[model samples]
Target: MAKGLCALLWLQKLMTELSHSHDHIKHIEVDCHFIKQNLDSRVIQFPFMKSEDQLVDILIKAYSTLDKLSMQDIYAPLKGMDGLKDEDHRNLIGGVVGEVQQHFPDASFMVFNFGDQESQSQIPELLSDMPVMNYPIHHGDCPILAMEIIHHFLRAADGWLSLDEHKNMLLVHCERGGWPVLAFMLAALLLYRKESNGEEETLHLIYNKAPSDLLRLISPLNPLPSQLRYLHYIATSNVHSEGCLRYKSLTLDSVILRFIPCLDAEVGCHLMFNISGRDPHNLTDKTPTVLFSAPERGKDIKQYKQADHKLVKVDIHCPVQGDVVLECMRVRAGLEHGETLFRVMFNTAYLLENNLMLGLDQMDVTWDRQNQYSRAFSAEITFLEMNPAAS
Candidate 1:
């Protein structure tokens, strides 16, 4: 995978040079340089693989003939069917199910629909004989909440997939604009089954299965940071455990923003923070609470000048537990609305250090121009204390 990624980076670099557009390469420039340095120093090398033998083809290219043939046969009945109409959609689904039954007579099928109630109801009545589970998820949903929901999903999905004695088939369906949640679920399943290891890589691989612009079109704000955070949780924690996962209590002392980005206003920028997480005091409440919000009502919003200093500090001291999401936004002078500068999400149960530091590339930024912020743009979150608890 490392070699494949290196090859991809090299290709991206070449494309950027040919197109003379640096926009697409900014995010990966550091990585490309690192890979180049390693190669120059003979520390690492990418061995060439024949096109026919390249396993990465499964991820980047179309499926093999056998796999495509199987899929076509199962979904042959739905050929040329219009997907926009409700009647057509229902018939298409039913026809596909009928085709599946014809192809695999003894196979048991399960449908997991990641869509809203309205979309779930659109499932054909013909599938009444098969098990259909509905798990509705909205766009830009809270990562912590998504984590809990994914836990339940993994339990049920894994149970069906593990039944080796019977030929079981799992069909995952999602409504329009449900790709984010669907991608996250697929990545989690890969990690749970030990088929993939790295959280970022697995998540990116799944998302790359679709068009590059699909995610941006579906979601305005970048969801990868929060998604990656949850992916890290899935990779590190034991989701198969019987009870709720234990989380340690921690206090966020302060946030230090270094090499702050230059804003359009001359008066600098007003920084507002919103920290949310599972209720530390109420274990039964599954909903996340706003642990802290800066610039309280009637209180003055502090403005920090980027040219004055290299570091900006915001004291939070908010108590948080379980999964935590910290978001920072920069408001221009005289403007009520603010753009999110970056977001960080993590679970207290997996905190092995007193502080969490993230570089520019590691965070989710709303801006497109990376040159506006210094390469040193980063955030450091200090933890005052952590109460160690059993896993």
Candidate 2:
């Protein structure tokens, strides 16, 4: 009984921490949410920065000094920090949060010295009188997006992007979705500033997506549907080919939430029209739309409930269970037109019945030796067009 009570108590605490309103936490406040570093210095000024504004100095200066900064500079202040300095840039961003493993690590508030060249390790004889400032990044926030924004600023041609002019760019939008939108604006600038890629690649990146899906989700530039589909919240809609699979459309869980039950302002449209200097004919509408079939058109549409049942191929081996069996299934809903829509979902109740992890997040077959998902698994429902009827 005591052990059970302890377990219950632990669960409650975890729930509280997970659901805590970020607004209540000042760190998660719009201005500080993006930077994960915790700073608590008492009026101790570096040679190049104001006492209280050391972080701003570090951030703005970092842009100009990125090419000059060595691995030693990034970690000089984080002395006691574990982990190798050579982690990938993605991990490097997470390192700011201190917990590198979590997709969204907990926010951190820390302070380390800047420009302590004498104390700096890993730098043999690199010379620098470069200005250094304390910078902050939130581990709990999206670091990859943050990195992209930083690079965008560095690579941008506009004088304003240099922070030398737009000194307060970081504080532009300090609201829930606003800060992220600022990042998207930077990222979008990076994409179109080149004015490169073909239309298909552009749409694919927008709808199908990239590692920086967070930027894509809240942004209002999806030109594919022109309107968000309201009824069915989402579909994988992946087209498979060539010994490997990739999403043809930039679609993901983050993308699904772009439009749904509710949508906020047209921040994306604003960026598209104003910053990019592009006409906003298609990306401006801010609401998800609905389509209803008219009775007149319904008579011409033939629906096939059952087209065929194709087993979902796992493309993996599973340890066979004596009495328990699992099967992959597929169902097709053929519309009156040429397009055939397929709905696919897990067929077994075994997962829920046994309290196993649903494994919904992993898009491809996963194999693990530990935890509930030790067995490899992945399944999908695909839709394709058959034959076109003359209009």
Strongest candidate by TM-score: 1
Overall local distance difference test of candidate 1? 0.67
Give the per-residue lDDT of model 2 (tens digit) for 41-88. Answer: 323221333322333332233232222222122222234453244444
Tell me the whole-model lDDT of each prediction, alpha carbons only.
0.67, 0.24
TM-score of each: 0.70, 0.20
Candidate 2: where are CA atoms >4 Å away?
A: 1-48, 51-158, 163-170, 174-183, 186-297, 306-391
TM-score, structure 1 vs. true: 0.70
Q: What is the lDDT of residue 67 in candidate 1?
A: 35
